[model samples]
Target: MAVFTVVNETDLAQWMRHYDLGEVVDFRGISSGIENSNYFLTTTRGAFVLTIFEKLTAEQLPFYLDLMRHLASHSVPVPDPVPRDDGALFGILHGKPATIVTKLDGKAELAPGPEHCGEVGQMLARLHLAGRDFKSHQPNLRSLAWWKETVPRIVPFVDGAQRELIVGELAHQEAFFESADYAALPGGPCHCDLFRDNVLFAPAAPGTNHQVRLGGFFDFYFAGCDKWLFDVAVTANDWCVDLATGRFDGARLTALLRAYQTVRPFTPEENRHWRDMLRAGAYRFWVSRLYDYYLPRAAAMLQPHDPTHFERILRERVMHADASPLCN
Candidate 1:
């Protein structure tokens, strides 16, 4: 949610007329993410998030907006897309597609505990289940094919060891993708980017044992149809990892998977390929981070994440492959 396309208050106040929302009380640019221009907008009605598409085109946007609407309809705690006066989910802002969604209630729990992990796991399982019947289909844009195309471009920026590790892991993932087991994995619309920051947590009510509830999940821009196990892997790689050393936290890992399995039991195939999927998850982020750090686009508040964090994660996943398990 970087500030790529600047939106002035004068322009925003004029644009607010398209929606039923009242006068713009306040709005500020959000500068934490890499994709799209996001603003925290508040009007006479309520709070909402405004996003101006940077890379995603109008043709490629409906899948995300529709998916959010579908999940919200299914009782998933996701942001609901607000329709315009003409019943459109989005409108043109600064010559690019833009939309607003209801802002979730709580804040992101960056320092998550076992209970937090459990909540995330349950919510994610429910999200996957909720999206099963969604009609729109779009492949994960940054999955295997994109990796193959991206690695060659990034190879020029790394050392011999880093290049060799990336190339070898890519070959391994290629083989895994070609396997019959991969084909049988269940598929659906998934919140492919379920990092900790994308989730919000509301503090427990008075006298509730201090158990925070999962407020909602956001950032559906990277979402797409993919194996449900892959989604789980991507989430686990973030929520269950020790951030400093890139190792799995057994308690958090167990809590996450057990909660998830209680909702939707994993198939035998998913369990069997869990470790490989974890490796795939780590590899995906590592490649993307390298690309972003080396070849970046100019945008306000766009701080490219350190590429070494995912490199450490990929190395851990590759070296300690046997340590990762689907559940306790």
Candidate 2:
């Protein structure tokens, strides 16, 4: 979500008119994420987000747009894609596949407590259930296969310790993927990147129940057909860990599991391999961060995250093999 491609006001206003969204009052680049060019848009109609795809091709984007539409239609709090006069939810803008989605109200709860974790857990479960009947099929693009292909490309940049960890984890994941335990884990459309920034929270109204509420989950670009258990683990790894030490927050972890189970209970197989799944989640991000760190693209506002953050996370999970946030 950085400004890779600049949009002139004249071009933006012309684009807005096609959606019947009224005059663009103002717009500015959002300089946070690494992949796409995003902008905060203000119009007479309301606030929206403009995303120009940096990697996803036009042919590869409908799955995402349709998935968001499906989730939004199912009462899930997702950013609904606004359609154009041609009735296409996405159209080319500035020679890139672009979309305008209703901006969810609220800010990310970066330092969420148990209640917030619980809310996200519940919503994630609901999203998985809602996506069960979606007709489109797309594999998790950054799954094990990608890791296998990408690891060698980045290993030359790592130190001794980093190299050993990366190699060992890659080997371990390869072996694990061949196991029945991995195969039996439930599969579904998953928000593979559900970190804190991807979720939004609205504060309670003056007369309400007195806490911030989970407003929505956005950033569906990384979503794909994957193990639902992996999705849950990925989420837990991010939402229920202390960043400084990579330690699990037991209260938040427990709350998330408890809330998730209310909608979709974990299978016995999923429960049995929860710790391993945590390792998988950690490994995924660690590899990704390492790749971005060493082989970064040109985005105007880009600073790749520290790969060691998730490295510490993977190391912690490996040490605490006895952890059972939910024993099922």
Model 1 CA lDDT for position 239: 97
Candidate 2: 10-residue stretch with minimal lDDT? 295-304
Model 2 per-residue lDDT tens digits across residues 115-223: 9989999999999999999999999988899999999999999889888988998888888889998888888899999999999999877887746687899999899
Clashing pairs in 1: 1-33
For residues 1-328, write the lDDT of model 1, one tens digit per residue. 4788999978897789889998888899987776788999998999999999987899989999999999999999999999999999999999999999998989998889999999999989999999989998999998999999999999999999999999999999999999999999998999999999999999878787758888999999899998999999999999998999988888999999999999999888888888889999989899988998888766522677888999998898888776547542
Model 2, runs deviating above 4 Å: 23-26, 298-301
Error of 1 at 286 (Å): 0.7
Q: What C-alpha lDDT values do all the predictions have?
A: 0.90, 0.89
Candidate 2, TM-score vs. the true structure? Answer: 0.93
Q: lDDT (0-100) at residue 228 of candidate 2?
A: 91
Best by lDDT: 1
Q: What's the lDDT for candidate 2?
A: 0.89
Q: How far is candidate 1 from the true structure (C-alpha RMSD, Å)?
A: 2.0
